[model samples]
Target: MKTETIGTATFETWTVAETADAFARDEIVLIDVRTPQEYMFEHIEGALLMPLSFFKAGKLPGQSDKRIVFHCGSGVRSERVCRAAIEAGITQIAHMEGGFAAWKAAQQPYIGTNMATGAPQRAPA
Candidate 1:
C-alpha cells in the first residue's frame, strides 16, 4: 500500500485481515477512535480507547514510533483522528479501510461490554 502523510504522521490504510496479521505479529497498535458509547457497544479486540475528542483536546498518549491504527464505527471519524494525529506530530499511523463494522463483517472477534454490568463480552464465533 502507498504511504501518505496527513500532517507529520505517515499512514497507510489496510484490510481487516492485514490488520489482524499485524496485530498477531505485535507490529501495530489498534486504536478505537470512536465515542465512549460506541466503544462500549463494541470494538475490535485489543483496541485502545483513545476517543477523537481526546485527540482534539491534545491528550492522546503513546509512542509515535509504534504503528498506530485508528478506527471508528465507520472510516470517516477515524480518518479525521488520523489527520489530527499527524498534526500532533505522530509519525506512524493508519486507519482501517471500513472500520469496526468491516472487522465484524470479516468475522473478526471483538469485545462487547455490558453497560449495566460493566462486564466485557467477546463476540461469539
Candidate 2:
C-alpha cells in the first residue's frame, strides 16, 4: 500500500486485483462513494454505499481487522472519502485504483439492475 498525506491525514491506495482478493477473502469493508442511483445501476457485491454527499464519519462501520476500501465511479470521490475517513481517525483505509470502472473492466462479478434492486436495499444501518 502506498501512503499519501492530504493535509494532516494519511491514506493508502489499492489496485483492483488486491481489493477484489480482499473482498473474496472477507478481509475488507468495501465502501462505494457514489450516489444511490449510480450504486443501484452497478456496484460490487457486498459493497456498502457511503455517498460523499452524505457521508458521516461516525456512521462508518467499526472494523479493527478488516481493511476499509473506498471506491467511486472513477476513484475521485473515493479519494475524498478516504481523506475524510483518515481525519476521522480511521487508520486502515484505502481507495481502489481506477475504482469500479477498473473492477468491471477486469471482468469481476458485481450486482446491478434488477438483480441489485429486486429486494429493497439501503446503506448500512
Candidate 3:
C-alpha cells in the first residue's frame, strides 16, 4: 500500500522487523488498536492498549505528533485504525503489515495476560 502523509503526521509503513527496529530505538509508539479482550490474549511487546473504538469515539489520549504504529489481530482492524487516525488529523501513523499473527509467525516475542485465566504468558523468540 502507498504510504501518505497528512499534515505533520506522516504515514510510513513498515514490515515486522522494521517496526521492531523502530521500537528498539524508541523512535515509535506501538499501539494495539484491537479490543481489550483481544489485547489481553497477546500483543507485541511494549505496545499500548488503545482500542479502535475509543479513537472512533473521539477519545484519543496521545500527542498527534507521536509516531504511531498500529496493529490488530491480523491487520484488518489496524488498517482501519490507521485510516481513522489520519482522518482524525494524526499525520504520523503506520500499520503493522501483518498484525499480531504475522509477528507470531515471524517468531517475534510478545507478552500478555490471559483473559480467561489471568495468567501472564511471554512468547519465546
Candidate 4:
C-alpha cells in the first residue's frame, strides 16, 4: 500500500495481491469503477459496479464503516474516482494500483467470459 496526500485528502494505492487478500478476508468493500460493459465481460467476484460514467461520490456504500477500494480497467479511471471521493469529503480512500489488468496478470480468480458459450464463468485459469 502507498499513501498520497493532496490538499486535505489522503488516498492509498493497493497492489493487486494486497487487494485480493483483503477482499478474500472481507476487510474491504471492493468497488469496480469501470464501464458496465467491461464489468459484464469480466470482473472480480463480489466487486460492486459503480461505473465511472455514472459514479456519484455521495452514493459511496459503507463509506464510513468499511474500507472502500476502487478499481478500473487499468487504474486510470479508478484514480479519478478516488479524487472525486476526496472532493466529496471522503477522506479515507483507496484504489487498486494497476487495476483489473494487474489482477489478471497476477492470475487472481475472477468472473471471466467463457468464450465457448459467451457466458460468465469462474476463471482461475
Model 3 spans with C-alpha error above 4 angstroms? 5-9, 56-66, 112-118
Candidates sorted by lDDT, best first: 4, 2, 1, 3
Tens digits of lDDT, candidate 3, 1-125: 44776766677667889888888888888889889888877777789988877766255556554567888888888888877777777655688888888888888889867556888888762
Candidate order by TM-score, decreasing, is 4, 2, 1, 3
Q: What is the lDDT of residue 56 in candidate 3?
A: 62
**Candidate 2 per-residue C-alpha lDDT over 48-120 given as tens digits, one digit per residue, 9 for 90 to 100:** 8888999988788777778788999998999888877878887657899899888888888887565644764
User: Candidate 1: global Cα-lDDT?
Assistant: 0.79
Runs in model 4 lying further than 4 Å from the true structure: none
Query: Which stretches of model 1 miss by more than 4 angstroms?
Result: 5-9, 56-65, 113-119
Show the lowest summed lDDT stretch of 10 residues, model 3: 57-66
Clashing pairs in 4: none
Model 2, 11: alpha-carbon shift in Å? 1.0
Model 4 Cα lDDT, one tens digit per residue, 26-99: 98999999989999999999999999999999987656667999999999999999999999998789999999
**Best model per TM-score:** 4
lDDT score for residue 72 of model 4: 97
| Candidate 3 accuracy as lDDT | 0.78
Model 1: lDDT of residue 13: 82
- lDDT, candidate 3, residue 124? 65
What does candidate 2 score in Cα RMSD to the true structure?
A: 5.2
